[model samples]
Target chain A: MSDSSSILGSTAAPDREAHLTPAANKLYGLMAEFESPAQIVAAAEKVRDAGYRWWDCHTPFPVHGLDQAMGIRATILPVLVFFGGLTGTIAALVLQIFTNAMSFDLWAIVWVRGYDYFISGKPMNSLPAFIPVTFELTVLLASLTVFFGLLLLNGLPRLYHPVFKSQRFARASDDRFFLVIEAKDPQFSRTKTEAMLQALKPLSIEALDS
Target chain B: MSTLVIDNTWDDPAKRAPLVLNHDRFDTVTAEICRVNEEAKPPMAWYVTFGISLALLGLLGVMVMYLLATGVGVWGNQHPVMWGFPIVNFVFWVGIGHAGTLISAILFLFRQKWRTAINRFAEAMTIFAVMCAGIFPAIHVGRIWVIWWVFPIPNQMDMWPQFRSPLIWDVFAVSTYFTVSTLFWYVGLIPDLATLRDRATSKVKAIAYGLFALGWRGSNRHWHRYERAYLLLAALATPLVLSVHSVVSFDFAVSQLPGWHTTIFPPYFVAGAIFSGFAMVVTLAVPARSLWGLKNFITLRHLENMNKIILLTGTIVGYAYAMEFFIAWYSGAIYEQFAFVNRAFGQYAWAYWIMISCNVITPQLFWFKKARTSIWIMFIASLLVNVGMWFERFVIVITTLSQDFLPSSWGYFTPTWVDWLTFLGTFGLFGTFFMLFIRYLPVIAIAEVKGVMPQADPHYGEEGHEHESEHAFGFQPRRPEDKEEDQS
Candidate 1:
């Protein structure tokens, strides 16, 4: 029974491989495990110089200078957040003014909704009073932008990735630093990429299966 | 081949004190921090405290129900002292909430690395304390059902909450504070939650943690955005913290009352809030560190640093107290002078003295290294500071209300049993939430703690590797005598 099962297992392996598509048969990426962040960073610089677009470095924590090493441009999140804050400030000022200071004229019928009532002898359009809420709203919208902007930019809430299929990828959040050159990269060729990574003297290399 | 000799003097483990002790590895940090959750069974002390907290929370519910069924009169609130315990408690709890934001957001922006150990629990405390703080104003409004009236939503009644009123400003300020703080905290927790999700042994645990993690993979792209978001949130929260308590002060400062009405109130109140908040953090952390076996992570240095903050804020609060008196005298406003005089030596002078002794006098001990480092001293000092902060609010609210310009209306305010119970019950609520937090969540940020370790640096001990390997591998050629002995 054991001999027969072993024979069956041997036969099933090729059958699975044969059933796979060409894209699936090809490696998902070449993942090189570096012993240290500096090693991965140095490797990243070399990879960047070699003009690999679809590649990334993964470390347990963000390594300083790694972004520069990988040649990643600065994100536009700050610009988005700044506009968000500006919108909040303007929106707050308009809301307060329209509600408290300005009268609404609808087809020659003046609505009394924007009643200019005096509060503690202060004018209806008290800009000083408006400042607190304006500041609060500015912060609120800017922070919300920062949060949502991050999620949108990173394309996060992504529950799955091909990288998870590699057994060694789990250590990316622990002790290891990894540089993956995606199969889809223009410069990528299985033998050439493997040889290039091997020349870097990485601790280990794995072909991630999609 | 010329080998690279990396200069690693800056990354030397011996040069810097370890944030995490026992020479922890990355996996060990995860295992240690996650141990409480993995064990799944809390110790007996946790159960006992949690049980007590739940009981107190139940009592608070009962009190609320009773007060709602009757009226605001069920509390000690009366004509002369309408603000009573509810407002005082509101301000006190709100003050307690500030320390968390200060530690997490302010310290983060300042680049204080020590905050990582305690920031998680402190942030949790802020959320829970705000919940407790929020309850008072809602219930204090008497018709808790119509609390939505505070919002600027268009209603058929055609009345907008007076936007100019600082009380209305409070509604915006506090709700905004809660929203921002919760977001900041949850954002920080996401990566840590993913770490927890990956380590979870049970299927149920894995799914639950995984869902909250929002499919975080710790991808480089994700981390880049996360870091940016975190920094912006910290920057945003810093001003929000100062603005929150400043606005809360506006609740009193905008009023006509002698003691409450002052330009100094905003800065004074902000300082007091931070002081009380730090005290509460120390109060919670001391027992928690021992209870959870988290001494190594929440180290003496962290405690000492917190004590130093307490000292600084405590002194500021003291200065504020003196400044109030000097300004009151300098302003030559009879009402202000009377109010200051009455607070220190009037019907409720005992309460004033308690506030002074606890908040001002006791914390001065923290100025000494021995006192700051000593567990017992810090614990007692923290508890006293909490007491002093509570009395400080009471002195501000009750004393001023109890004795106004009209001597005819002046009366001594005394809290009814229900008022005391309700205040005590918030403790239960805060404890219950905190106990649950530590029981389930990663109390210390596992990822953050590991991030600060020496091994996390690529250049750590790079220069010493060859010398260490000689001793470790013993690769020196074996002597001929040793070979002959082996042959014999």
Candidate 2:
């Protein structure tokens, strides 16, 4: 069950032949395993060459430099976070402006039956009073931006995925390493795909039959 | 021709008890260590925490009911001291929150592997602390029901919250902080939840855990995305943590009040937040390690590292205190000069001394390695730090306001019984959440700690040898058994 030997010892490099068994895809795909970080990276590169735009690399821990090596771009979550924070700021400003400057203007001007009360003779729309709200909005928006943005960016709440169907995939969370190329990738073909993956020196190659 | 002694850290294989490979071995080890006996189902520590937390929670509940039934006027918030226990509690909880972020984000950036054991708990504390913090400000508002007025909306009442108000800014700062902290906690929990889901016995636990796990099959694809997101969150959170506290400090600094107005408030507050936060972590963690029998997991090395930070930040905060006094003297502004003078030798001189002893003197003991590593000593020091920090807030709030610009307006502030009860309640609330976290969630982050093992950490390839030494010291790894068949 350890299967460490098969994963660690792949000698038939770039074996170009394909044995066709349509039913073998699910089990076969999982049989092909990765033992080291280097092998996973190599498989990822080949996955990219095979034109699979959407795929991932899984490991027990964060694999250093995997994102760049896998050619994943910077996330849009930051920009989303920025916008959320911007909204918080604007909301804070408008609320204060309406309440203190516009809404309360008449009372301020009237000044309790013309008995003059002055806070350093400052105007009704005092910008100084707005500091707290401005500070709060900036924080509010930015925090929300990060929170909701992460969820949307990750497409979370997904209760199922094709990878979950493979029992071997579970170890990817604990000890194993994996490189999964989605079937939706443009250049995905049975024979050429397996050949390309074999060249990348995985333990073995298996099609995701399902 | 090279004759050099290359002493490996892990010298021998099979030195310690084998790693607990099967679920049964792991569970038995935990049950024994955690003191789960059928006759005596709950441990003494459990009773203490539960009883204390429940009593505190009851006090909080009753106090909150009174506040709701009457008004915020129940507590002593009179002239000159407009912000009282509510603001103090708010600041204290926020400060408590700072340690978690310091542990999770800053240490994460530095790749300090030692943090793995406590980061999960630390982050949980952050979320809970923030939760407690959020409650204070909500009730601080006189019309608690209309708290939504702080939000920006074109309501039927034709009103908007003041944009430039420091209070409004706090609302945003705290809410944002809460959101980000929650997400950070949840994101970190996903993999652990998946682990639990796979290991679940009952159908309900499996389904519940599975749902939360988000169908995470640990595909390379999912991990690739998850890691990217985690790194991004840590990056975002680091600055956010600093800014959030800076904004909190701005609540006081932007004011022209004698003690409150200062340019250095932002950095000063942030440093103090971290200082107070690390102190709280030690206060909580020392007891937790002993009670949970996790001495090996939360090692002396970890305690030493935290103590070093405590000392460094305590010094920085002390420096801030000195600089503030010096600047006040140099400015020659009568108001500022009087403020500093009154704080040192005025009506609240006792509070000032407490702050000095707790914040300044206590952390100095950490200068010695022996003191830092000694749990009892560190615990006492941590308690002093908290006491000092609370007094620091009290000094800042009370001393400056007690004597304002006008001689006629000078009046001393006093905390009534209500203030004491409410303050005590918050402690109850904090303890309640922490106890709950310990009971349910994996307190030690099994996966993360396992990752730090000799087999896991490639840099420390000889960890296997240290097992025997670890056992002699009264700790042993779980016995190994194959559960691979069940897993596959």
Candidate 3:
């Protein structure tokens, strides 16, 4: 048996399209729900063509090719991660050389002097021996860059998003696929948007607002 | 090419194993994985196991206190056998962590969909196991107070750590490994955490989950970036995993000791690490699946596939053992020959045999499908494999250092009560973290699991919808109270 959560509210506001005043409607957006990926993907393509730049499609997981449907360009996260790794490699290389090969008083909170020495009959500046730490540092910095870069790019650690306003959108992380056309979209006309969403034949539609 | 588990009544061609079984809709997959965390109480066995773990954790605490107060002399580590139980435990626990990384990082790169079911669990195990592993090394330095010397922060002593030493390399490798693994695990948890945040039944749960969820709304724009970052992490971790174990092996291979100084050690150690790590995974997964009703998610196919890897890696381990002996004898060096002969037939011969039979012989049973699929057989074999692996580390450490090249300086390494308790207590440490993890977090990656289901495909509705529609009942929407939970 299904829990109470599984019972979805099917609010079909089809006839309520386009007559309301702008002052009467204070909305985050109109979120159109569909049961399957095919529906939402097909609907996303239409929304993209209609010039809704601020719109987005929400799904439970990474919907393959949905980015293409929404016309999302490939992220520059990997390129940044590469530079991050490069920084780490140079940092490790300099640190090891400065400490192991030559002593220098560097600036931080205080001037800390590097201790140059030799051991294991190996050269004072041993590149082969330094590779392991360098490699690990490269990976460490690259991984950190990927995570922080993603958060910065995505504008995350955000406490709230307007999409969470709709009770229907709760299923966005579960089964439902939602196409949200924000009120802030330049092409947004309250009446015209609902009329366009109606043409997509969504399972349900919600006009969400603060 | 993406593999789809078709509704295989007839006319199916690709014939790959189903990733998720008996679940038609995406939400049910969410429900099942979340149910374990949302339930008010876990099964009775959880309490029993948790209690034992806590008590053992207490023992570990007491032993650490005693060692710090008294001295390193409380352990059996003496002149020749300076690296004893602590090093053995360190290597064993570290090696055990590799399986999780292999599952999470390597398999993900290879696009193995089955990894989604168990990757979270394995990664959690990796972090906890590393924590236990870290404790042994930190304490074994004999001076716990000046442990910061491991770092390159300039000190009043004007002394820096030896950069060319394998020991310093290990410090960097392991700490870096731990940090990267933790970040990787957290990143994977974001979508799943958001699921918990949305479906949270309480205010506290919602806030806590929401904070970590980082306001993930599964937007295509965000998912597009998230997926790319995840791929980058996986790629970075794949090499990190190999390097971590190879650095650990360098702790031995770079040594002048006859048994330890072999070029074969790196690949051999990596293979053994994966072998033992998979063994531990099976051991943990077997009881866990049954206890949590996760059979459908971590299906029989997943277990069978793991058993196949165990068999493959286990054989490689055996071959390495044979090759080590051949390499030792072929070099025609008296000390190398003596080291190999002494390992097989000398003082530590008993421990060597345990390693052989447990690691080599036990996994060979998986060649039979009955052994692979049977819960009892695989579980027992896994337990044996863990024992064998621990002994494998024991044999490598103690045998070489005990007698080595000088018979007069020979010593028999034996564990003191503190040493034994500390080693046993790490299991408790590992178990405690694991128990809390399973109780709180979605034990499986809910979002990743859903991604593999057929319904996630854009064309799922177009292909054979009739077969799925019958079972796609109760597939939509939220509970009445969900709004209050969210708004609160």
All candidates: DockQ: 0.26, 0.15, 0.39
lDDT of 2 by residue, B1-488 (tens): 13422211222554532222222222333333333112234558877987898899899989988998988778888887778878888898899899888787777777676677678888888888898888888888878888888876445555555455567777777777777777877877776676655555456656676778766555443444455556667776788788888888988997899888999899989999999888888888898877766665666667777899999999998999999999999998899999998999999999999999899888999998779878789999999899899888889887887788998888878887888998888888888988877765666655455444443322222443442111100111222331111000
Candidate 3 overall lDDT versus native: 0.85
Instruction: Give per-model TM-scores.
Output: 0.90, 0.77, 0.92
Which residue pairs clash in candidate 1? none
Residue B364 Cα positional deviation in candidate 1, in Å, after optimal superposition: 0.6
- In the range B1-488, model 1's lDDT, one tens digit per residue, is 14422222133665555566664367767777788777868889999999999999999999999999999988889989999999999999999999989988888877787788999999999999999999999999999889998876666555566778788788888988998899988888887787776666666676677678776766665565667778888889999999999999998898899999999999999999999999999999999888877877888878888999999999999999999999999999999999999999999999999999999999999878889888999999999999999999999999999999999999988899999999999989998999999888989877677767766655557876421111100112333332110000
Range of the 10 consecutive residues with the lowest summed lDDT in candidate 2 chain A:
A1-10
Worst 10 residues of 3 chain B by lDDT: B467-476
lDDT of 3 by residue, A1-210 (tens): 011122221122322443555454367788899988888878988888777887888888877657667777666787899999999999999889988888778766477778768776788889999999999999999999998998999899875666765777778888889898888998998999999999999988888763
Query: Model 3, A17: alpha-carbon shift in Å?
Result: 27
Which DockQ value does candidate 2 get? 0.15
Global local distance difference test of model 2: 0.68
Residues B1-488, model 3: lDDT tens digits: 23433232222455545678888878888899999999999999999999999999998999999999999999999879999999999999999999999999999877777898999999999999999999999999999999999999878777888889899999999999999999999999998998988898776787778778888888877887888888889999999999999999999999999899999999999999999899989999999999999988888878888999999999999999999999998999899999999999999999999999999999999999878888899999999999999999999999999988888999888888888989999999999999999999999999888877777777675755532211110112223431111000
Measured over the true interface residues after superposition, the C-alpha RMSD of each candidate is: 15.6, 12.1, 9.7
Q: DockQ: which is higher, 1 or 3?
A: 3
Candidate 2 C-alpha error for residue B451, in Å: 6.2
Q: What TM-score describes the B chain of model 2?
A: 0.86
